[model samples]
Target chain A: MAGLEDLYREIILDHYRSPRNRGELPTPPAQRVEGFNPLCGDEVVLFVDLHDGTVADIKVSGQGCSISQSSGSMMTAAVKGKSVAEARALIRRFKGLMSIHEQALGGEADQLDEDGADGAGADDPDVKLGDLEALQGVVKFPVRIKCATLSWNTLTQALDEAPA
Target chain B: MTAVEAGRKAATPLDVARVQADFPILARRVHGQRLVYLDSAASSQKPRAVLDAMARFYETSNANIHRGTYQLAVESTEAYEAARRAVARFVGAPDPRGLVFTKNVTEAINLVAASWGGANLKAGDAVVLTEVEHHANLVPWLMLKDKLGIELRFVPMGEDYTLDLTHLDRLLDGAKLMAFTAMSNVLGTLTPIRRITDAAHAAGALVLVDGAQLVPHVPTDIAALDVDFFGFTGHKMCGPTGIGAMWARPELLEAMPPFLGGGEMIRDVRLDGFTTAEVPTKFEAGTMPFAEAVGLHAAVEYLGALGMDAVREHEVSLTAYALRALKERHGDDITIYGPSEPAMRGGALSFTYKGIHPHDVSQVLDQKGICVRAGHHCAKPLLRRLGVGATTRASFYVYNDESDVDALVEGLSDADDLFSL
Candidate 1:
């Protein structure tokens, strides 16, 4: 029951009201990606610019529930000015926070990407999700877990599509 | 009972506590809170009678009909046919043979589109539908338009969410069929079925009344509405799923070709040719839904015992209560999406709170064991026309009382408190 109280904190609502990096980056260099959750009609579009294998800038625009839209704001703020690898690391941590099991939901949970790396959970002692941990309560509301992760998942796709 | 509970019991006309007792699920909880179900517009919770009827059928007489000569088979066949007659009578259609059982309302609509539209419609023919139709009613006709080159005209909607029929005469001109829902599932707007039926008939077109939302809540008479087709499903009416019916005139059914072809739907079959069975059987195809039909029959009896007039009267008062409570409590923060008057709507209430997304509202409501529908509700075009992306709908039913509406109000207030700046 205490977990339910933490699910919608004042910070999350503040971000939902005044979102950070809440627009698209202007230029051809930015890689754009769109993600939609047809279940609730939540949509998020992410724009990113990769400079020297790092995220030079990021912006997001979309309409959705408080959780998803606020998550978009937090995600843009979390990964901006970080290395592309660091952004990927943040995504991995974010998903781990939102994941139901210790392993990822799909059968390929154990399969590491080309980096030959460990499938580490976001609770890693060295790397923390920081303020994004506020969203850890999302796992409590199974139906709304997708709303909190739509932006991060869409941002991951934007990273993949970004130019090296 | 709690004080709030006693207050609601006094406010509501029906004995909602007794009604709730008939549904075992109402005693259960969602998210560790007492369940407050408000999605009956989607489907009603089954009463014990419907459940017992189904269990009794499966326990005693679960057998294929029309073929097996054993006692169980004979009993099953009798029960199935009796269910059809019960359903037909419940809707005030005189002849049971005039009813064709389909899997659900979507299938029933598709059956009409495929069978009647296939046979009667040509490239030049047109079908008139409303802007507020559910996908079940809209998609089949759109598919028909794709298959054949028929023109599909739509009746636009007013700001209040009812159909704007200023040019309905022109829209119905040269139309072979006029299909519409008796009630709008999204906005809870009750369409003027009698007026629309008269207009469609005057325009020389047949009509289909999608009663999926209307039939369960009100006393419907196909003869009084004077529509050619009455489509509805059983699941939403407190019966089991997998059974629905379309009531049409016997002569009209005789004229339309069979929708699905299978063993039960044929009088005789050969490699060379086959003869289709009579009206209902010709449309049913394969083995019918025997047990679900029994449950639906029990549902008819349950509703009849409650008296459809009283059932409707209770909801009318409940809707009025909800509308006033939500408005008086939240004011501009809450925006209901249907007619301001309770007379012009069913129990389904689609609305939004400030700018908080409906999904979030539904999620919060679910925490309080308040179940609601959030999204376009399979009526994307209507939602788009309403200038909103999605809405949270808290619909009422026979089991709902003033407490349920109070629960909804409390939940919405919670939504605003948690999400507001």
Candidate 2:
């Protein structure tokens, strides 16, 4: 049986307990979107502030299970202050990490290893997933995948509808 | 004893052991312990009779009805129509033609909302529903309101969880339809259906009763209650899943348009237009669940043999015993919802332990080989009204005995210890 340690990773729990940038952003230059998982009553509201074609700020407020809340917390922290292009790239990378295809990246594993402990090497040939790689464990539990991706999906929607 | 003497004698109580024998699944073990099922309100355990009926249908008489032209077709048609008669008789409908088979009660309610509600309700037309309605009953009407620009109203429940008729009267004005549950699945409050229906009819509004919880536990005669429409499911009444019935007045069904259009529901097809079939068949589109209908028919026979009055009595006794036992054992440690009078409720109890979440209680019960349901139970609005996020519900059926109730109380006590504040 997979223990709570795998599910409630210390970093995830820390983020859930004290989520970063948790609030609403003003609507003038920011776009807001809501996401809901009907199965377990998890809901998330994502607000994005765009400044000069970059994500100046990202904030989230919601009530949900620990996995969803922590995932939202991690998402906001990962994309904050990044350019629109960078944020979109991070989303794609996060999707790749959560996808079942990650196991096929074996040949590129050594290149990823040289990216340093933070997993932030842009020069590495391998996919450097950064902090979002921690969510790979969620795929084992099929039901929790929705919880982990709900906020990211909401953020995608918010960014899509955001004024250019 | 003479036959008259035997007939006059008081009926024997429901034999839990004998009843348990009819259910094949009950003989098995779950989690290395004997299964103690206490979640019948969620969905009932199917019996051998229902299973065999379904299997027999598939084995012998497997053909499309109302569209085929062979010996197997005739037999299949007979069996399917017989099941419709069985359901109609079981619910005391005046005619079998009034019963429309759907996937389940949820779909039945949706059919009425889409068909009858769409044709009748207009902009500013009001719909009065109770706070205790299942999402099946609530959402369809809300969808109708959103589509038609109608106003929706709610009848509030008292602190005891019973519908307040005084408030209902006030909300009835300008209401074109009143939809409610005969018995709440979560709270187990048996709303006074006859009174509410009569009042709605007097106000010139039609009433739809969601009988998913009530039909399994008690005998329902649509003629006696004079309800405009009643919805019930098969799986909740010891039948196979994927089949249910909606009983509406013949005229009401005749007046409503077909919900889903397809082969069975059409009289003739043309490139230009097609005429619809009669009531019942008009609503049942596509290839029907013939085997499931047979299973539901057998379930009706099983309940009839047991006698609904006896079943209701047994539930009353069990619920009363449970209420007293839980109250005596826990007192301030628990908060029981719904009517305190057992006779006023159905075969379930919804309660909250003072300091434990329902999920925690369910886990403790699961350890003891007892299965109960925890969560909002698909009635989020009612749960919100009760001022709780969720509840621990233990529902009873014919197979349940006092021992099951004792086990539940013991499990809760254990949960209290394990999850102390």
- Which numbered prediction scores highest in TM-score against the true structure? 1
- Candidate 1: tens digits of C-alpha lDDT, residues B149-225: 89999999998789998999999998999999999998899999999989999999999989999999988888778
Model 2 per-residue lDDT tens digits across residues B60-85? 99898887889999999899999999
Best by lDDT: 1
Q: Which 10-residue span in candidate 1 chain B carries the lowest summed lDDT?
A: B4-13
> What DockQ do you compute for every candidate structure?
0.51, 0.11
User: Distance from true position, residue B396, model 2, in Å?
Assistant: 2.2
Task: Give the clash count for each candidate.
Answer: 0, 0
What is candidate 1's fraction of native contacts? Answer: 0.64
Off by over 4 Å in 2: A1-35, A42-164, B1-9, B328-330, B354-357, B360-364, B413-421
C-alpha lDDT values of all predictions: 0.87, 0.82
Candidate 2: pairs in clash: none
lDDT of 1 at B234: 95
lDDT at A153, model 1: 71
